[model samples]
Target: MRAALAATGRVVRAETFRLLRKRRMYVLAALWWVVLPVLVLLLARVLQVTLTGSFVEGEAVSVKTLLQGLASPFGVARVGLVAPAYLSPSPYVIAVALLAAAGLGEPRTHRMWKSTLVAEPDRRAVLAGTFLTMQAFLGVLLAGAFVFGAAFGAIGTTFLPTAAEGAWGRLAGLYLLQWAHLATLLAFASLAIFVLRNVTLGVVTTFFLPPLVEGLYAVWRATAGFEPLNRFNALFQGLELQATLEAVPRWFLSNNLYLPARTSAAPLLDEVVGTLQAVGEEAGGGPGGAQIASLLGADLTLPHAGLVMAVYGAIFVTLLVVAFLRREVA
Candidate 1:
């Protein structure tokens, strides 16, 4: 078992490094993590300014107040670091999903699996590594980009972020929930890759099929007695199966979680959304920047949402492994 675990770890590390070796992945990572987040931040701050300016008729607005409100860069702990991305089937997920599914589409084209099997000889370990590597790659790309963007966004808004220990715990939980979400995506992407058996088709199906089905489901739900997929309705979806957040947790946007956490204990994290709507209401972040503050929250107060992802992750991962083991190599 120890040997198997080691082999899995090695495979995961190797697969992760293998993906990193691709130059385009970096470009895409930068586009989603750096460029997109910063762009979102700037636009958010601008919008805040525009709205605040338009609403205020005549009052001596303090510089301090302006500064306090200026750190509007989204998904940066002000609005639950995952909020902006959770708001839609973000390019971050799409790009990652496409890259993962596309490359692994058939695997026969790459023909690395036979060598991989010879080296590792454990199919389960191989599959586990592949799945984990996908998530790890996503996490590294996301966290790396987030660190830069958060630091840049932190300017002027903070005197010095001193996030509480509780805040760090909540943040860690939120990230765990986020990983569950990514796992669900990878499971589906895995299914798409193997089933479609073509890179282009896998990409198209993985990215596009969900939204198409969602539209039909929406109309059906609207028209009559549709209810099985009611969960999908509440969470907005577009382009495909990519889900949009219905209600994000309000974390109270303590700036410390955004900056100081990085310089200190790396494992501790902060919230992006509320663990539960009730919890969000209770935490009372007048500023509101919650994510999963507890295991109870896990991306949403809705057990249906969390449960769906969890169930889907399990089912799909199992299916993919069984399917992969059976797959014919050309």
Candidate 2:
């Protein structure tokens, strides 16, 4: 058993190395890890200028003035956004799905099982080795993102606000969820790789299936109490707070998780659309910055979100292992 496990580890490691050796994979990984964040930060700064000006009237703001204002708010603002990305599961799904699918797509390159089969003839071992190695690589890639996000967050402090422990904790929790999300993607991709025997089909399945499943589950959940696949949505998705927030009357943008609400007096597009008529309420009133500050006065929430994601990882890892073990290598 020990020898088999050791050999599997070696095979998996080799698969990771094989992906790393490819120039295209290197580029995609770097773009996700390094390029995307920098661009996002730059864009965030730009958006801060544009949106704040649009929302706040007669504020006499230039881009420079807006940026200066943000320096103080940077930490808090980041707490709301960038910190989440560090911990968000969305990136991991994307990273693992694309890379692993692509890696499996070019099976001719790795010929991973060909040599191993000669020695052991255990197809399960070969499959396990490939899957385990890919999963580990996905994990490393995820950790790298967290580190980069946190580091960027620290730099953001230079312009934003100081680090808060609560924010850091949430970030950690979010990453945990992201790890689970990655595992699911890894499992799905590995299975798809084995069955489809082509990367594009696998990639498409990985990319499209989560949302499709979630969407179908949502339709079911609307009528039925709780849908089974509904739990998997966040694991695949980057946290989109705006979409989930339920606007409470002059109080909070409640996700029903009891975090403080953000205050921006702008009416949500949904509210504005006449498709859904409001029952005994005015359409245009929302909270202000003070309200947001009041709601999020403290970041005392434990990471239920991350914990949920961990469950996803655990479930899928088991499934993937079983599938890999049972599948025929040839």
Candidate 3:
């Protein structure tokens, strides 16, 4: 047992050092962990200033506050429509593509595993080392996000924004979503390496093919009403930073932020009301029936979309583990 643990420790340490030596990892981490969040915050602030003629202040600015403020604008500052354009999923997709390529495809590209196996000769040990290193990297990424978010949120407080429990809830949800998103990227990247055994092509296709597939698939599903592919779309949706924005309630208009409404009611109540209205309209009811029935309905909240991403993650990790076990390090 002691000897096994020692080997595992060495495997982990070696993998960590190997990944750290890669300059690309440093560049990617800096861009994703530091630069992107700052850019997003600045853009949000700019939109606020341009529209309202002054920034929308938050009582205590949170990441959610900044995003929500930008999502819906007030009178004369109605360029809020441009908000979604800036809030694109492209950054994350690109980052994840790079990570997937590095994490799964690197071993194959460099033929590192063959040499490692000669020393440890234990396939499980190699797999464990690789995944533990990935976990450590992910932990750092998440912690950095939390710190960046807190700082960004503090800076936002100068703008005097509204606060809600849901905002914080969404913040927590976003963190979890990051894990699910990365895991899915790693899974596909790992699969690509398993099949092709080449880092460049596997990495390229892992990143490149998805957007095209998503676009075409989206169109096909929309026209053909394909059901299975719709759930696959959930995988794409869950990875996006803006996915949480879509899931959250855009309750009030931009200018009405200061005027408090009857929100003392539970968030579930509102979610229920909204869902019923949506379903009722789809069912061919008039606006009056929709309005009348909406009040009577309850919010049918399920596990967050983040949970769906986690489920995909579980499937992904399992497949990668299986691939690592079955394949010879040729």
Mark the regions of model 1 whose C-alpha exceeds 4 Å error after superposition.
Answer: 44-80, 83-89, 156-172, 226-302
lDDT of 1 by residue, 43-140 (tens): 54564556554534236554324433334222343333444344356554475566566346535557777787788888788888887877777676
lDDT of 3 by residue, 190-299 (tens): 66656677767776776566555445543553354223556555575567633442222221111011111112123535666667667778989733333332222222
lDDT of 3 at 126: 69
Instruction: Give the range where candidate 1 is weakest over 10 consecutive residues by summed lDDT.
Output: 248-257
Better of 1 and 3 by TM-score: 1
Give me the displacement of residue 182 in model 2, in angstroms: 2.0
Top-TM-score structure, candidate number:
1
Candidate 2 minimal-lDDT segment of 10 residues: 256-265
Candidate models: Cα lDDT each: 0.54, 0.50, 0.51
- My TM-score estimates for the predictions, one after another, are 0.65, 0.58, 0.59
TM-score, ranked from best to worst: 1, 3, 2
**In model 3, where is the ten-residue run with the lowest total lDDT?**
252-261
Over 4 Å off in model 3, which ranges?
Answer: 1-6, 53-89, 155-170, 208-217, 225-311
Best by lDDT: 1
